[model samples]
Target: MTTQQLHEQILLKKSFLCVGLDVDLTKIPEHLLETEDPIFEFNKVIIDATHDLAIAYKPNTAFYEAYGIKGWLSLQKTINYINEKYPDIFTIADAKRGDIGNTSSMYAKAFFEDLKFDSVTVAPYMGKDSVEPFLAFENKHTIMLALTSNEGAFDFQTLITNGTELYKQVLETSKTWKNSENLMYVVGATKAEYFTEIRKIVPDSFLLVPGVGAQGGSLSEVCKYGMNNKIGLLINSSRAIIYASKGTDFAEKAREEALKMQQEMEEIMSLKFKV
Candidate 1:
């Protein structure tokens, strides 16, 4: 989806929520395991239940990779279901993949062409050559890791270099790459205070924000500094919503959780945009 289409969805839905389909088999409902493909079964129900409450769905690739071939198949089916059933909603392959130039190109193909995800997360450690390949795909966004929500983020992302934080440098240097307009970024909600500074560098760019809910990132705080004129944020909530229950009512419970976030987001937008 193009950036404008995504923003339109945000307005139509009155939400900037991105439900993270980071399914963990161990954490899912026990009854789902009896199904042929537990992962996909779980995902389908969640998608159906909360698709309207969210503007995007992000399936972290690690969850599928853990189960091997069957998991990969489940991943494929999930993306296909989303594309065919809800083409308007954005899909993200939360595969933080980055490698050498050639390898990155293939990785991009796997997610952008074969799987048909609208966007894929990528690491920027390898620099422009590794990321520009993914950005080459038209209308497909390359969400580069900027400031993350993890405890270890300070190890490298915040390290001062040339009198600036490494992540700021990454954001500055990334703009110089070809097709850089297609680039989005991953800014963890835990670092809400950093959004003010981040916006200074990439004020118009979209940010895929994780670390809310289960990770304890304050939604209101993130929005206070992170939101732009277009409401440029995709706040992701994973375990908290998907694992709301491990019973037959899992999907229903998931919707309840997502609705809570969506309602919160709607209120934020109304107060911020005066809609």
Candidate 2:
């Protein structure tokens, strides 16, 4: 989806919530284990339950990769289901993939062509060549890592180089690449205060924000600083929402949790943009 389409979805839903499908088989309802594809079954329930409340669904690739071919098939089924049923909802392959240009192109194809995700998360450690290939795909977004929410982000992202932080440098440098407009960023909500500075760099780019619900990052604070006129923030809540229950009412409980966040997002937009 184009950024405009994604922004439209955000407005239509009154939400920028991205429900993370970090499905762990061990953590899911035990009853699902008996199902043919437990992972896809769990995801289908969550997506069916909370589709209207959330603007996006992000499936962290690791969860599926760990299960080998079975896991990958589940991931495929999950994305295919979303595409067929709710094409308006944005899909993100939270793969964090980046390699040589050729390799990145194949990775891009796997997610964009095969999996049909609207976007894919990428690591910036390999520089422009690695990311430009993903950007080459029209209407597909390459969400590069900027100031991530993880504790170890301080090790490099915040370090000053040439009098500018590495993450800031990454943001500025990424703008010079081919099809840079397709770029979004992964900015952690835990570093909410930094959003002001981040906005000054990429004022219009979408930010895929994690660390909100489960990580204790404040929703209001992230919006106060990170929100653009388009409300460019996809606050993700994985474990807290998806694993809200280990019983048969799991989908209902997930909807309840997502509703709480969606309502909060609606209120935030109402006050900020008067939408």
- The global C-alpha lDDT for each of the candidates, from Candidate 1 onward, is 0.96, 0.96
TM-score (all chains, Cα) for each model: 0.99, 0.99
Q: Which consecutive 10 residues in model 2 have the weakest lDDT in total? A: 212-221
Off by over 4 Å in 2: none
Give the per-residue lDDT digits (tens) of candidate 2, residues 1-275.
Answer: 88899999999999999999999999999999999999999999999999999999999999999999999999999999999999999999999999999999999999999889999999999999999999999999999999999999999999999899999999999999999999999999899999999999999999999999778899999999999998988999999999999999999999999999999999999998888
Scored by lDDT, model 1 comes in at: 0.96
Error of 1 at 58 (Å): 0.5
Decoy 2 TM-score against native:
0.99
Compose the digit string of candidate 1's lDDT tens values, residues 155-209.
Answer: 9999999999999999999999999999999999999999999999999999999
Error of 1 at 172 (Å): 0.5
Worst 10 residues of 1 by lDDT: 266-275
| Candidate 2, residue 261: how far the Cα is off, in Å | 0.2
